[model samples]
Target: MPTDTRARMVTGAARMISRRGVDAMSLRELAEQEGVPLGSTYHHFPGGKAELVDAAVNHVGDRVAESIAGTRGQGTEHIVRWVLHAWRRILIKSDFRAGCPVLAAAVAKDERHRDTARAVFGRWTDGLIDVLIEDGVPPVRAPSVARTIIASLEGAVGLARAFGQIGPLDDVEAELIRLVAAAAGEPAPGAGR
Candidate 1:
């Protein structure tokens, strides 16, 4: 719904990549999907498909990091639930057709795409680690706990998409809350609710 053609193209490319991945997403299809002329894609992304893919990856990555950062004082359980609910909504809204754009890029054959994913994942993990530390999780354990949460959620998203259900995400969310609670030395909120 972005009025700017370039922004629309980037958002559309992210959605396309979520479903079809990097190698399978063609610029021409992206143009048609975004209702932009093929030449405009070149104008906006002079580096061609690689440039567009990078932009799309960064777009999704920034959005996700910002979302996580927004939950600074909401407590660990709320943060975990919020993140899982966001993914669950995406799965249901897209009819299980879409997964994470960054994950899609990470699995691509292109080294550049993988590198972008690595940086994005690092940023997300760092943000979560900071939030965990804020919630009283030991600094020593926050990093590993953050990484585990992200890795498990990413895998759960893929499983949810593949199985056409959100059960995988739900299961991961429950376990993640317990993992985080244990790390924070606090009782798990709504434990086994």
Candidate 2:
């Protein structure tokens, strides 16, 4: 099954824009990277740069939601592990120099882009919240807990990247495991120290 050229171009552009800020992108540059002709780019997105950016933002959001949906219905531990592995893959794919795609777009001024970013992040939080609620957290608290975990993980990634070491991520991972365990009233491994 062959994918339509526009969809392929959008997918490639979304990956590139996620790894490199939108401000640094151009249609010509995207065409070159995608190996698609300039005429085809305009044929697919006649509105040009703004339209391309919009498509890219939505494309990335859908990609993220699809990834999270695949990991649904296991357990909180599984979700946590999936998140860690996903973050590691993103970090490596971007050469450890880029912030998260949704996070970057959140700080960007374009309202539509930010909305797309928020939608993507909301899906991730909601997915994790479902796992947390299943693990016995109060339904009302699950979303907040999920958000805290996400914020902490992002912060840990930033710190680790800034220091050029993975210690921050490792510490955050261990602490996340411990926090989730304690929330479930499971005995922490090395308690009573």
Candidate 3:
């Protein structure tokens, strides 16, 4: 099998496993979703389901890191806008069907899967903290702020999915922007928060 085909299979399987828990996923299902031959799947991931799943998790995590890196623009407002845009894009593009990918993996029954999720999540949070510190937030507070920002976004995603509406995300984004600005000692907009 081609490397691109195997990569597509990894992403498709991850998305499917996220929508339906890991227990509901199988190698054949992933191959079908990727429109690849079942035999090709084994050729790529000889270890089978576990190997494919781990690869998917890592692939998604790398994407998350790239997204974060892309969001580091001119200033704090730029970063906030970028973050908000990312969520809006995710919600609109996905039809609000799934929550955070890391959160989805975190809920997996298998300990190995959960650990994979945690490591990815930790990398994302640490990346955010690094960006915050770069943007003038005090180093000591960066990690806490990053964790809070992640929590707020994750919580908002959950509420949006649960209520079938996007209002909660909007509200959370508003407060998050204010908090990020305040932490950086930037001039908050008059209507902020």
Name the best candidate (by TM-score): 1
Compose the digit string of candidate 1's lDDT tens values, residues 12-102. 9999999999999999988988889999998989999999999999999999899888988886678778878898889999999988899
lDDT of 2 by residue, 23-67 (tens): 666688788878888888888888886677777777766766676
What do the candidate models score in CA lDDT, each in turn? 0.90, 0.73, 0.77
Q: Cα deviation in Å at residue 192, candidate 1?
A: 31
In model 3, pairs of residues that clash are none
Give the per-residue lDDT digits (tens) of candidate 3, residues 1-193.
Answer: 4488888988887787656666667888777778899998789889887777778888888887777777665644565566667777777777877556567678878787889888988988888887887777878778888889878878987888778778887898789878887888853234366
TM-score against native, each model: 0.92, 0.81, 0.85
List the candidate 1 regions with Cα displacement exceeding 4 Å: 1-3, 186-193
Model 3 scores worst on lDDT over the 10 consecutive residues at 184-193
* Ranking of predictions according to lDDT: 1, 3, 2
Q: How far does residue 182 in candidate 3 sit from its true spot (Å)?
A: 1.7
Q: Which predicted model would earn the best lDDT? A: 1
Clash list (residue pairs), candidate 1: none
